[model samples]
Target: MRLPSKALIAILFATAALPAAAQDTAAVPQSATAAALECGDDFATWKQNLANEARTAGVGEKGLSALANATLDQKVLDRDRAQGVFSQTFTQFSERMISDYRLKHGAANLQKYGTYFAKGEQDYGVPGPVVAAFWALETDFGAVQGNFNSLNALVTLAHDCRRPDLFRPQIVPLMTLIDRNVLPADVKGAWAGEIGQTQILPSDYLARGVDGDGDGIVDLRNSPADVILTTARKIESRGWKRGEPWVQEIRVPAEMDWALTGRTNKLPLADWAKMGITNRDGSALQDNGLKAGVVLPMGRKGPAFLTYENYDVYLEWNQSATYTLTAAHLAARLAGQPAFDRGNPDAGLTGDAMKALQQKLHDKGYDVGGIDGILGTNTREAIRQEQMRLKLPVDGWPTDELLADL
Candidate 1:
């Protein structure tokens, strides 16, 4: 999740100030050659190159000045590289993100800003708890919006060769924000350059900003009303259906085919019911003429969920499975749902343990992919295959016992 610091800085300096005319010229060095240059070798050059890109992207003088003032922020780089969320299991991630403090504060914010949420729900047909869930998960109900300089962070990322393709295009919208004065030059936010109480990216803000506070300004950073309403608008624009459950924890029979359990593989409720799927409490699953996919983030040993169309809308906000699940589960909590029935808080294996397990599986001829210490689909599938080979319960969870046996 974090960029390689020395490599990123070297690339930023080496690519400095190459003119737009040089972009197509063979004389211009590639990102690889540029990344090998000395640190701060030609920072002015990089900034000027970025300025040219901004100009081409239609940014004006105010935007140019904002970019000019940006400094290479090592702290932003550190934060960008320290994203540990990917290493966390669903239980671990949920426990931390939907902490007791967050839940209590989120509920309070929902009440304190009841009228604003009510209006947002009414207008967008998005539920109040759903909006509140995003608010809470994003920045802990506005308690901890990160303090990194937005322009500097965005510029640094744009300059870095590690993910220039992804971060470079974001510079233009950020410049536009400065040009329009939607955000000040020194605005602070998450290291990836998301701003506001909801941690909206500059591009999303530009595309979906809404005035909810009746102050005639869509101030997402300061106005909870705007933040909530704009978030509602964003999810709606991203295809959030009115009156739909995002996801609900459910149980499937042991004999059910494991191949069908993923976000992309949808089946009708009737089919699932026929296979002995039930609600969390052993109740019958209602067939509502809707299709849902079974999602087992923690594999068979963990909880299962029937994810609906609105769940995909959550993906548009953040692509992480746990992130989307956290917000949706938080929404369920805010709406008085009970705790999930199947997750074990102690089931998470450490990163090193995961790597060891991956190595052991790899040695056994299982395609575990790269041993990055993150339990992606390939890793989980390998674990499942190993368990089946050993005649053990094929739950797909990497445990200390499993590692020891391997």
Candidate 2:
């Protein structure tokens, strides 16, 4: 269930470097009104209003000029509207993300850039394997960073009201970058606006950028050192514990309380051991004197993990649990861990079918929240309760038979 690498767009800024002289060089085009005729009047008006705000925020003339020709990208809108359901097993995700190509390439990159990794580890307290995992997972070590024009993507998303709050704020920092000439107007990235090696958002780039190379400028797209170290710093800023494990796959006893499953229970390791949880190989669970929550990724059957505080740092990077798990698992593999067992199960339901199932469960008062088709915590819990009611396997996963029954 790797998160679809649909653009990870973001903005960046060099606020202090933006001078009035630099702003004056790029003039706002007089044809903005005519270009509005192409993207529609609403988009034109939105751009104008935002441009005014950018001016007040010190974006200066060059940034305003860049925005004057901004065009709407339908692909960005389409990608935003699209939502995903986690259906792939851990084996599937691992095979796709941790392919031999990635493993070999990632290891090679680790060696090639050993100095940066070492400095990153020393400065940010994040391991080289973890940073490499992120690099491999996000844009495949920068090989497949999307080619969409990041400015157009951000402007289009900001104009679209569906999620303006999230996309609009990013525009200013990007304009700041343009004003400072740190990024060219034609710079491209994923459709969603994420840029650079780690596919970082613009706000994050501005906040967490590090001069990993000796050069003063933090060039994320071109400098692998900056990219890796920036990522390490960003995770450390987001509360990555220095030496704590992110997650460990574990075996659970048949009689273990199903209620204790999920990512928020926060039971101590000893308490979980008392409840019959142990290492995946059925060895006694080690008492690390730390609290952990159980993550039943595919319910009680597929794969279970004891997620520690560091797991939350992965969530901070990507909200999707599946995506975080992929990064963590990749990190483990890079550290020489073997593949874990994966149980065979039927193919999961599609997004539409899952939406219908969520609607059905919600209608039956199972509290699936809204019918967006995403199998979030509410929907999974609803499925679990319904499974219990129907005397079926209470794994919280949906099946065709369960849909028919509903």
Candidate 3:
């Protein structure tokens, strides 16, 4: 593992410097509108007030004009919801992210950007394949960065009730960038308003983005170097350790303690070695003096991993084991490593079964929200609550046995 480059570090730090005031107003669009309409009794006047607020926040006359002209379409909202549903499942999400297409393309990227990766490795201490894997996952090698208008998406989400406080400030920066011609007024991106090659949020881009290609403009959408380095910078900022492995496939002893799994507990390498934990190849644990935890992502029967701080660093990038696993697997493939020996068993569940489970949980007074078969946060939380209520292991996972009982 290599350290992040100074330039990349600077970019990461700058990007994370979001204004506190902006965070205060980050709400989703529809929810915001509903709140305003309810409180003010006038939707038109409420929108005007929002526009005036944008102007006061330095969105500028031109940006405000564009925003005023922009209309919220139900179709965009529907599309976003559909996409969001698709991303909820770890099994399905990981399968696509770590698919053969990504692995093949990631390997090709390593070769295409060999010099860049080599230099990045030396200068930033970030592995080349790791950087490439992030690229593959974020935007599919820049092929499908998204199609939603960046401003519209941000404004919509900000005005919506779910997370208006988090997205409110983004509107100002987005508008300011457009006003300054740093970004086009009609910039397109993911449904959540993230833009460019690395899927960076507008606020992050405004603060931390760099012209890594030295083109005098930090265009994450078009500049590979900027996107790659910016990602490396984010990893570094999250405290990725240099010269250390993120995770290692391990052979867990059949009789070994299973209580050590997850991030809750850690043991020194010496302690783990004393406890008879070894690498899959039967090698001893490294005497690196660092603490690590066991992670059985699938279950007791599945492959286990001894995860390091760098694994946590990767988690900080996406906060999902599925996303981190896909990135790690892709990185390994890019480095010519073999895929995991086992496949995901919980790969798919029929829509009907999902809906049934959702309804059961909801009937039991667990807030699964409407039984739509879409596994969003509410559904997962409800599942966890149900598991706890049933005295089952609280992994928040859905299984055939659990569904049958329900």
Count: clashes, candidate 2: 9
lDDT of 2 by residue, 293-343 (tens): 988766666677888889877766665566677778888878777665574
Candidate 1 yields a Cα-based lDDT of 0.72
* Residues 170-189, model 3: lDDT tens digits: 67677777877888888987
TM values, all candidates? 0.82, 0.84, 0.75
Model 2, position 96, has a per-residue lDDT of 61
- Model 3 TM-score on a 0 to 1 scale: 0.75
Per-residue lDDT tens digits for candidate 1, residues 254-336, read 66666656776788898889988899989999988889988887766578899998888776666557667877998999988
What ranges in model 2 sit over 4 Å off?
A: 1-41, 83-90, 344-353, 365-374, 385-395, 400-405
lDDT score for residue 266 of model 3: 76
